[model samples]
Target: MVETVVILGAGWAGLPLAHKLLKYTLPEAKDGLKVVLVSPNSHFYWNVAAVRGVIPDAIPDEQLFLPIEPAFAQYSSENFEFVLGKAEHLDPEKNTIELVKNDGTQRSLSYDQLVIATGSHIRSNLPFKPIGTHEETLAALHSLQKQIDVARSIVVAGGGPTGVETAGELAAAYGGEKDITLIVAGDHVLQASHILPSVSQVVEKDLQKLGVKLIRNTQVKEAQTDNAKRENDVAVAQTRTLILSNGSTLTTDLYLPLFGVQVNTGFVPPSLLDSAGNLALDKTMRVTGTKNIWGIGDVGNLEAKQLTVTDAQIIHLSSALPTVLTGDGGQVVKEYKPSSRKMIFISMGKKYATGQIGEWRLWGWITAYVKGRLLFVDTAEGYVGGKHLRHASM
Candidate 1:
């Protein structure tokens, strides 16, 4: 009997897990074992560079998008399968999942073990995540770049990393040429619970130096387009009127809101989710009260959604899954413990950066060399090739 492992979402979590299993676990496991990866997009999106990707000629399209199918061509069909579709529903009781394909067709799949890594999306329509199919994401990116080219003024809402990075990129590209403003709802930016005030202060100074106007303690209440008229069936580029929380109105040529993140858990059952609609997982990354189903990446509520956290979870789960597949009752797999030390890296355009690990603040040049220079796009292909997994195992 062939036992199947069905993994959902091929972003940071599912893609690496699938590769690791085929490369390491399947060869050692019982003869009958296979891995199936399902995702809405056929391409893996390198969204870490999305902040700079929006800027004209900042990063090429090839660096940001890579086909998911070709990455798995080395594995034989008998051991691996890649399904292009979105998960429509999950029936944990039956160990089955329902998926809706791109052509509006539905398919059902059953698995002995399941992994949920569906991740999350930005609140607004942005290229920060895999917004839809590969073509759709590319379209969004191109459209945003075109807007940025022509826009004289840009307003970015939300004080998070994306917002800060976007503002910084615009400032760097068009500092004295265009108007760039960043609106932070709180008194400081990078307001994640673990970030220190000093870190935020440093980031603020960097942004200010880059010529970004900081609007502190203010939020965008509403945004209304000044014109709805279409030019030759396409909506014309029009000014946006933003109503601020402080009872002021500001108009800009472009408005970008990078605020909240909504996890893609609609297919999951309510009982398995936390209050924020994220999968409730134990330290082992297993869904609470479930044996065969596991959760990772932004979809899991175990820790904050950071690339470093996601990478750690992927590495831990990959090592643990082989033991989990054996169904040995007495053997215990190591539990996943998230790091308590605060770690963050913010790239402020091409020239400057700021971040901290634990209590130590990284120098600007260190951050630039490590993250800001290429935004990790150089390693994008390695991720698809499972180089990270091979390196980790050694």
Candidate 2:
């Protein structure tokens, strides 16, 4: 009897891991193992380029979101399978996972091993979240752009990279046509403490030069989570209101919140989650207290959820899985070593960016090229075929 390897989520870690699983492994170790990918979405969005996506008509929809079917067509007939839906429930004790189909039916698949990499979500009006299809996303993005075009006053809450980038982009794109204000809860943008002091200062200087008003030590008192409602209000509201924790009221044409990232582990039980709803994983990327289930990417409680770090995790798992899963005893298992240094590529716009490589902060067109230019949309296109499972364009 062949064992099954079910992987949940088709993000950075899951897709690459699927490719590796198909490339290596000789089909069987006494009984063999098959791989199945479960996801509710049909397109693998180049979500990193969302800043550019929010910009009206900046890039084409095909560049931003690539259908996964083209990528998976590269693979020949094999033991791999893709379920068109999301995991509704996971039962480790029974070794079975249930997936809810698009038509609202539930399908259960049993597996000998499982990997979870559902990723996280961010709350922002910059068209950052993943939608159903490429065209739908593009249409919504155009709406956001229209709102940006006519807005007289813009109040952007949160000092994270998205907020900073949006503020800068709006100023640069509009050329001081709109009054752009950035409000951060921390001492400086990017949480200040998270990046080098000099790097943070440089970012602020860039925003100031772009005519963006920086308001530090402030948070949004009125929490809004509905993206559709946000869009509707942006089109309808002649003047949007933002109530701040500092007791200051902002009247603006647009209120964009670049705030918290919500982890996508709601399908999972709390027993497998941390305090923040993130999947709890051991040092080896194995889910806590589970011998066969692994967690990776933003969904896991890893120090860094960057794509590079997730790739490293996949690399380690590639070498470790065969020995651990094939019933081979006494195999040396390598523990995942997460990078101690912090690395980030934050775009001020397509022209400028700020980055951190270890102790050094890289700031120039190089940063812009690395992450800002094309927003890596072209790079993401190279990885379309890894996830071949698509029932719908969405």
Candidate 3:
């Protein structure tokens, strides 16, 4: 009998791993080991570029949407298949997974080996406000575009990269016609990062030049929407008047919330995840206490959830899976160690960006060209086709 390999959640983590597994033929492997990838989406999304997606002149959607067939066709042999559905339940004891298809059908699959890359989902509740999902995200952007089209006063909540990026974009695009105010709960933009101090200085100077007001050490305490009835549509209120923790209030025609995201780990049981419901893994990316199981990328409880780190994790973990398959279950095992490189790219709206490579800060058009330009959307297109995107046209 041939061994079976099943990978769940064909997002960033699962797709790459599957492709690599299909491409690499193990030396000690048995005659036939079928590889199966399970995902609701046939295409892979470049998550890092999601923020840039909201920009008016950002990369086109076709470049960002990658189909999985080409990737599999390039790397996989005849023994690989893609199941168009979601893994609803995982039965570790029986080494089986229950799948729910988009067409409302169901099935169970047993895998001799499994990888759980079922990435994170947005959380609805937090100290910060909520941003909508899918169509909601697009709708909010459209409505804001309309508001920014005419309104003079705009108040943005959240001081993180998302907030800062939005403020920068608005200032760059509509600064002459709009008054942009940025509210940060902390003292500086990108507060949680370890970038050089000069980066923040440069960012603030640019925002000041663009006439964007920076309010630090403040939080939105209360938000009242322009149309109260539409408040429900906005995850946090669709506010016109926003009251701050510092007892200050401002009235505006448009409000944008750039707070953090909520993780949806409910799809997987808590037993497989940590106390915080993040996938708990031993050093080898294997789900703790679960046999023939692995976890990677944003789904894991690891501190860094950036796409760069996630991609690295997937590459490292997938390389070890072939070794594990050659050995008897527990006797021969390989340990996995994560890398220590931290990289972040922040889009300052328009076509400008600031990237932090370790402790050094590199800014300007190169940053924009590298990531801020098309958000590596063409890379996504290439992944789907299983060919390297030599030139990703912006």
Candidate 4:
């Protein structure tokens, strides 16, 4: 008997897990196992460097997007299937899921086990994550770059890593030629509760050195694009009128909002989700109240949404899943332990960076070398090629 395992979403978490199971677990299963991966996009987007990707000519399209289907060429057809669609419905009681294909067709799949890794999307329509299909994401990236190329003044909202990195990229490319302003809602940027106050101070200095204008303690309440304005009967480029929280209005040639993420759990059942709509998960990463279903990555509420945490969850589940599937009573299922220490690195353009691990702050040069220079694009292909499985095994 062949037991099918359906994994949803092929982003940072789902893609790697599929590769691991196909390489390490499928061959070892007593009952034959098959892995089915479902995603809305046909390509794997390396969105870690999306901040710099919006900057013109910083990175090529080939390096940023990889075809997802070709990566699984090593696996046999009997063991793996990649479906290009979005998960529209999930019924755990029947162990079946319904997906709406890109062509507007529907398909129903039954699974012995399910893994939810739909991840999250940026609040605004940006290329930070897979907004839709591969072509749609590519179009968004190119459109934003073209806008940045001609915009004389740009306003970036939400003082997090994306906003900071974007401001840095603009400053590095255009210097004082263009006016780039970053609006921070709180007193400082990188204002996550876990981050130390000192880290924000250091980041502030880095942005200032890059000639990024910082607007502190302010928020963008509303932004309206005015495209009909003309000067001397000649049409001008569209501009954005921003209404600030401080009762002030500022207009700019371009506006970029990089903040907040809405988890992609709309298709999940309400009973399995928390009040915030994130999937409720146990310590073992299994969906709460369900045995064969598991939730991970940004869709689950076990830990903060970060790539390191997502990677840790993938490593743990990949090791523990085989025991559950094969009914190996002798082997124990290891519970996932969330990391308490704060670890993050923010790259300010291509030259400077800032990071903190626990209570220690990393030097700018060290961060730049490790993350700022390339944004980990070099290792992105490994995730798709099943090479990450070897690294995890060791």
Best by TM-score: 1
Using lDDT as the yardstick, the better of models 1 and 3 is 1
TM-score of 3: 0.83
- Give the alpha carbon lDDT tens digit for every residue of 1-394 in model 4: 9878899999889998998898889988988999999998899898988888888898999889989999999999999999999999999999999999999999999998899999998889788888999999998788777778778999999888778888887888788989999999999998999887888888889889888899989999999998734544533446989999999999999888998888999999999999999999988999999988999899999899987677688888887789888878655677899989889888877788888999888888999999988988898788777686322541
Model 3 clashing-pair count? 2
Residue 277's lDDT in candidate 3: 73
Clashing residue pairs in candidate 3 are 122-262, 123-262
| lDDT per residue (tens digit) for residues 108-217 in model 2 | 88888888878777744245765433455556677777776667778888787777887887787777678989999888887644578777878888888889998888
Residues 72-127, candidate 1: write the lDDT tens digits.
99999999999989999999999999999888899999998899999999989688
Using TM-score as the measure, name the better of candidate 2 and candidate 3: 2
- Sort every candidate by lDDT, greatest first: 1, 4, 2, 3
In each prediction, how many residue pairs overlap at the backbone (N, C-alpha, C within less than 3 A)?
0, 3, 2, 0
Kindly report which residue stretches of model 2 are placed more than 4 angstroms away from their true locations once superposed.
26-30, 123-126, 131-142, 192-194, 223-238, 327-332, 386-394
Q: What TM-score does structure 2 among the candidates reach?
A: 0.89
Better of 2 and 4 by lDDT: 4
Of the two candidates 1 and 2, the one with more favorable lDDT, higher being better, is 1
For model 3, the superposed segments whose C-alpha errors exceed 4 Å read 26-28, 74-78, 124-154, 228-239, 328-333, 363-365, 388-394
Candidate 4 displacement at residue 364 in angstroms: 0.4
Per-candidate local distance difference test: 0.88, 0.73, 0.67, 0.87
